[model samples]
Target: MNHAATTDMADAPVLDEDPFSDENIANPYPLFERMREMGPAVFVAPHGYYAVTRHAEAGIVASDHTRFTVEGGVGMSDIRKPGAWRTRSPISEIDPPEHTRVRAALQKILSPLVVKTWKDKFAQRAEEIAEQAVARGRIDGVADITEAFVLEVFPAVLGIDVPPERIKLTGELNFNQLGPNNERVARTLRRAAPIMDWYQQVLQRDHMRPGGFAEKIYEAEDAGDFDAGTAPLHVRSFFRAGVDTTIAGIGSTLKLLSEHPEQLALVKANPTLLKSAFEEALRMESPAQVMFRTTTGEVELGGVRLRADTKVGYHMGAANRDPRQWEDPDRYDVTRQTAGVHRAFGVGAHVCIGQMISRLEAESILGALIRRVQRIEPAGEARWRPVNTLRTLDVLPLTLVAG
Candidate 1:
């Protein structure tokens, strides 16, 4: 390496912490605070990658594709390297102007009109489930509410059939694989092995429900909007990208509401605050904790010079809670206006296109439940499901006290 580059790398702060370790995964904010305190971007020695913890640096990395490209893949290990993830996401793993074309085509299929059509369906189902939960009085919010709702709705809209078990396994596997190839990845892969064929088959054209997005993708490809044989991958991307994260976000919102009755009251008193309640929950506990970007060349991030072609993780979970960007960052306040600012939905060209859909899903269910129940209270402790890149609740025990 050249002298200037070598000195820059050496000058960067090195943190010998594993963000993906079991303890950290369970409760990452503690380590995130330390990393954020260290610098804007800290070099993670064990993984040989830079960790972008602060809000500003994370935003820059997420938006500036020229400096930090997606061509090298948006995972910790470079997809260009041998033994890394073999397949790439047609939507998220490419850079413009090709990315622009792909995204436009996909957007055409999921136009606002098409998405708006799902609202009534989403609301109807959400109300039914919310009413059921209220009648029961106590529930596992994760299974009874969030998972139950998303697993049914998201796939129906995307035009795919997937068992909840496979969805969970694949969600775990995909997120874990995005980070270091640790035991978590291995365990999920093994459990998912039997369903691998089903997973692949479910996204095919024949499996698509008529008039759904998946079928529309195939039609778009036929009309020459996309390359032949790429439609299935798009459907796969849509399902994976849309489902679990929405479930996680909704699950977190419910758990948060149960924990803070006053916040629940805020939403219930002013139904207009319902949208912000979901946004605040996402800001407080982002679902997809981090996303990776590759350093296209020697770049200065948060004053730290990073090596070329290396993975840099932008921890949105950290950035969302970054004290510099937020007041009382640790507290859960439903009134917090964090939408569009929080890294939970990301930023720039690659910002989550499914964000509006996620928001709608969250609001539909949350609004229904909030209206139906007198109060949401903790029936038992909440549990987090650990995956390398995804932050989601596993179990949320709650009591829906009826008014």
Candidate 2:
């Protein structure tokens, strides 16, 4: 790797050319296209990091944690560094062997039997929310449906008493921390400033409701399922990963279905397709857009070589929509056999542990809505919230005529 050769790849097209730029964040697909066209691994000068764009390459990078460790921190900018707002999530911020132990403990706690028990609870809440929204004939899809379902169910499951109003502030801080310390990060940090100390209190065992997952984590810790003091961190990981992602995926689905009535009709006709519909939306507009790893040594992805100890950012949003991997990549179709094929939950050892919980939540709520609504009509424009690594809707108004 001579200076000239190093400079060539380093000078390649930046994937997120303007990370804090609203126009690019609002619609990142064009930039995604540019990165996919440039090379598998591109040196994004804007963020001063290399990003892996294609589907195969993204999967390879995500799975090869040995070559690409998570210990440097999973965000685009390392959170372990000074001035980072978030404390590291123990489950996601460590390499396997250690990660494997923590994850296995969580899996046992969040087992299928445990998740299955929540289905009835989610179903009841789904019916209540959907019926209320349908009665009104018009509703803000983001708040009325997506946020309503997640805010109700997710917190209850986690045992945390997080106020609904504080969610956006905390979420903004989390998403902004995933990228560079740009204006977005500064803005969100200020908003979340008042609650920073309280956020820590909420994650503690004393605040968790009895019989909730957070308490169960503490129980597990008592039983030696995990090391002492790691339980609260595990709970925080679930809270951070679970809530916003489900909201983003469901919100994106509603936004797309509103835009494409034909697609909406397809899901209405077959409620079972709700699963595939959500999966498709996740593939199309992933909630968490980018994830990163630190290279253990000089490694090769596609044909490009990365230096040891460097950060390798994997763009899941770009990978899922890669034309080479998906037919008519940009089109939103519920009929596509997207389940198990997409990397939205990640792949290999670090795949999302709470993925089943997310699917169950989506199926319960989206299924209830599909069954009750006759048609999903757009009432007004939908707007996306501009967070550095999350693609989510800020508002989605809709007219839901009852069946």
Candidate 3:
């Protein structure tokens, strides 16, 4: 591909690296630093998309819907283009006015009272899991702790009845579709093919258990809060957004705590630091690594002009670690204040709607472990699962010492 004059913006650096490659997916910080240094917005030649690598520029791209819109879809490829993923999500894909109304209805269902009610149940489950993990002495933190707890509790809360394997398969499929359609997407789709029918059925009203979040979504649809036939898609949006990302975050927290005993000590002493620990871990690794937005028109970002109707990728993992945003950006400081500023949960109007739920889940599990375990040490090598667009652990081997 010709690197010369790819975009009208002469200053925009053309980066030839494939951000989604297996090597980069495993360890992206080096590439992230390079991308940030190249310019705020670098045109990726391999993917033919401009990447916003700095914290400030990424925020501008994500928040300013008029200039950078989601109408083209949040993935690397535009949904309007050929060979794209299925239609855009009603929640994440639409611009405001319409998005505002749908979001308001969903917010009503996930009100504080409802979240508080779920917290009680989550705490109970966390304590049980903590006790079991402590007794085991050594465990795979991903499979044994984060995945075990979230897969059971979150699905129960959503009123969906599906096995853990199916959930993992579908989560992999969802994240892969958000990136360039490559061998990874092909592989995941083939693997999930057998259960695709069941996956669709489970999100439907008939499969939603009474008195669960899924059922409530259907109820809201019946009341005309959502357009007809969009209820199932809403349920799907929640499942796709809520589950794997939280699992990735909680798992990353455990890995961080295990690797840094002093940070773990701080959290164990204060207990309140568990929330900070989770946030810091998210900033360090960032579960949802990259999201896309298309240019609504000619837009100036980071002193460079991007052409109209082009896709710009926000590398969240890169932005969260941008030195311009945080001092010693690479260090995992549990006390670091990153809530609103961090690009992990996102920024502006489309900031993750289910963030409170994720926090509640993380606090419940991490709080239980911190209270019960004296020390969290690495038992073996930690392995990261390579989904096209998600940064998550496949296995985190840890040893729990009883308090």
lDDT of 2 by residue, 1-403 (tens): 2334443344344554674488889998898898889998887777667788899999988888767888888888766678755667878988888888888888989999999999999999999998999999889999999999999899998888888888767877888788877888888888888888998888888899988988999999999878778888888788888999999999998888878888889887787788889999999999999998887776666767677677788889999999889999999999999877787888878898988999999899888888887788889888899999999999998999788
Candidate 1 achieves a global lDDT of: 0.88
For all predicted structures, in order, the TM-scores are: 0.97, 0.95, 0.97
Cα lDDT, all candidates: 0.88, 0.85, 0.91
**Cα lDDT tens digits for candidate 1, 151-240:** 999988887777888888888888888888889988988888898888888878888888788899999999999877888878877888
Kindly report which residue stretches of model 1 are placed more than 4 angstroms away from their true locations once superposed: 1-10
- Per-residue lDDT of model 3, residues 1-403, tens digit only: 1223345555578988898899998999999999999888998989889999899999998988988899899898999888767877889999897999999999999998899999889999999999999999999999889999999999999999989999999999999999988899999998999998998888888888888998999999899999998989989999989999999999999999999999999998888888889999999999999999998866778778777789999989999999999999989999988887899998877899999999999999989888998899999999999898999999999999998
Reference-based lDDT, residue 398, model 1: 89
Off by over 4 Å in 2: 1-16, 80-84
Candidate 3 lDDT (Cα, whole model)?
A: 0.91
**lDDT score for residue 366 of model 1:** 87
